[model samples]
Target chain A: MPTHRRIDVSKVGDVTVVTFLDKKILDETGIQELGAELFSLVEQDNRRSLLLDFADVDFLSSAALGKLITLDRKVKSAQGRLKMCNIKPEILEVFQITKLNKVFDIRAGEAEAIAAF
Target chain B: MTDHISAAGWQRTFELKSDRGASRAVMDVLLEQLGAHDWEPSDIFAIHLAAEEALVNAIIHGNKLDSTKKVHVDCRVSRDHVRIEITDEGQGFDPASVPDCTLEERLEAPSGRGVMLMRSFMTRIAYNAKGNSVVLEKSRAAAAG
Candidate 1:
């Protein structure tokens, strides 16, 4: 059965980190239901660097991609940054096709993404 | 018009969440049970994708995170087809204006692909206005040519 994997949030130094432990974000099909939640965070006043750690994610759908872009733009407009770390190749391919690879700051790992700032 | 098929090959209905994100397990179980009814791989993927799109819309847009709101799904299988109905608690929108994802203008956008893909993969698709429900239909092929 598909489960809506929990997404844990934390503040690491200057970055507000979101860790996804499941390969699939949506309970059934990799679609994400957390768009509004992330958007709510991006729209917050005390915005810090946002780091998305996908250490356990192997796939993400286009809808999930939409939510990321929405948050990425929201943070950037607030003078902050959106950087991602630990994305699987299969999922990265989706990003590549959507031209998001050029739009988002994607890193090989958390250390690199955090260092890029 | 509402399209439907009644088959005893499989039957199940589950309810818990206002958001489609919460009804995923039900989707997986339905897919597996439908497979046992002789549904093909392509049939399974198509139904899975359609259900994903429908349920997400019902939960995200229909229920709007009102946990009190419920999203209901019913799956039934007959001799050679699988039918699914997904209903939500909110007022539905106009399906006429959804952008065609196949167009060059939207090929890169992250959303809007759900409705388009659902239409393409399913044999028949219908929406009930008053009920805020999306019905999906797909036919299964027989074992012998």
Candidate 2:
């Protein structure tokens, strides 16, 4: 079974907001569990819109980034939109350097992200 | 040949097993200390991200997560720079051979992004001739003076 222990998934209107419960998401096991939860949302629940709230996350490894990229693709293929907000400036640099900033819909906070959807 | 150096303001080296989880744990503690020292937010990000990528590559790609293998790291944080060296105990691959992930065709590819991230964030990145060792260096934030 997929465990959502490291994350809090809630709904804000029609959008699904996932807030990371941990300070850092770097371990393989944590990434695997998170991946399972996210994929289940897309494949089974068919949740279309996603807002990843990173207010609590301090760091993310490349493996974690890979998982996010994979999840983004899955959401897109399902004709759903995925976005993230409240990313720490340091962690946000990763997305900018990788040019994923151009690929993902990024906003300043939950209110703005939800409004965009 | 120097296992210890006082030239840099801060220096530490760890001989780590090829367990990704343990390696990250060690890095976490070191990063916390660096943060406490008031390393610039940008410099901290670059160093931490580059170190994580390099360490992961050494443990997973190089050592294949083999518990028998080991990874070595040397970290030096001076007033104006953060330098890290990572070495693994496996056959190496050519760094030049990695594809350009920025290309439209390769953006979605799962692999090869780590090398790209390291190069993007670090000011200087180089691999030893054997390709088993990598060095990442980033200039620290300018002094507030």
Candidate 3:
């Protein structure tokens, strides 16, 4: 298994549950590392179902959003699934503001997100 | 480099490098001052988001991370509102020509949403004719809570 610094990886049944280690995902270097770790799950690990739990994330910038968009594309190209949950209300407003709420599968909780996968 | 405090509010000016780390440090100070002034959490979040977008745009897109270029920031926080102006030393682009990121076909594109988010969160956002300078203002009452 490759070492990861920006995310915590676990297995819930067949689904891969990834959690962010940073509360604020605004720094460029951090976002780049995060994007690499997320892309690796699909590109190297061949994880078919991925669930991103944002329970620890308090903030994110447009650059972070760009990473998620790229990750979503990578998963789709790999014929995999991606879902996100536990986004705080403030961050959810960001998704709604950018209309990204329509682009990804968002759920209310981890259980709900996992079940959907 | 200039910081002024009065009975009403505080103001500070900074000349930052065209680097993310440099900009992040400045943002931390701004957020700290906002908290000290007892700004509402939601309002702080909005200000932080807008400021982050604008700074990143100036540092990355405007200045292109040129080591020689500097990004100037002027911030004022009053009881009722906060205003920030960021100017970069680069050839500016037309803000009016920025495509709408919320459009149906453009929804999946990741790069263009920064400008839109700034406009949505700030009470008012204006860019200089040169396009390298931008002012972001948010009034407490107008903040989307």
Please provide TM-scores, in order, for all candidate models, with all chains considered together.
Answer: 0.58, 0.90, 0.98
lDDT comparison, 1 vs 3, better candidate: 3
Candidate 2 lDDT tens digits, B37-107: 57777667667777888888899899999999989988877667778899999999899999877677877
Q: Which stretches of candidate 2 lie over 4 Å from their true place?
A: A1-3, B1-7, B36-38, B141-145
Where does the lowest 10-residue lDDT sum fall in candidate 3 chain B? B136-145
Clashing pairs in 1: B19-B59, B20-B59
lDDT, model 2, position A63: 84
Give residue A7's lDDT in candidate 2 (0 to 100).
78
Question: Comparing candidate 1 with candidate 2, which one achieves the higher lDDT?
Answer: 2
Q: Write the per-residue lDDT of candidate 1 for residues A4-117, one digit (tens) a residue.
A: 235667787888788875666545333344765566566643556888999887545557777787787788888888899888765675565455777788999888888888
Query: Model 1: DockQ against the native?
Result: 0.17
Report per-candidate TM-score of chain A alone. Answer: 0.83, 0.94, 0.98
Predicted model with the maximum TM-score: 3
lDDT, residue A48, model 2: 98
Candidate 3 residue runs with Cα over 4 Å from true position: none
Task: Per model, state how many residue pairs clash.
Answer: 2, 0, 0
Select the stronger candidate by DockQ from 2 and 3.
Answer: 3
lDDT score, candidate 2, position A43:
93
Native-to-model Cα distance after best TM-score fit, residue A2 in candidate 3, in Å? 0.6
Residue B122 lDDT in candidate 2 = 82
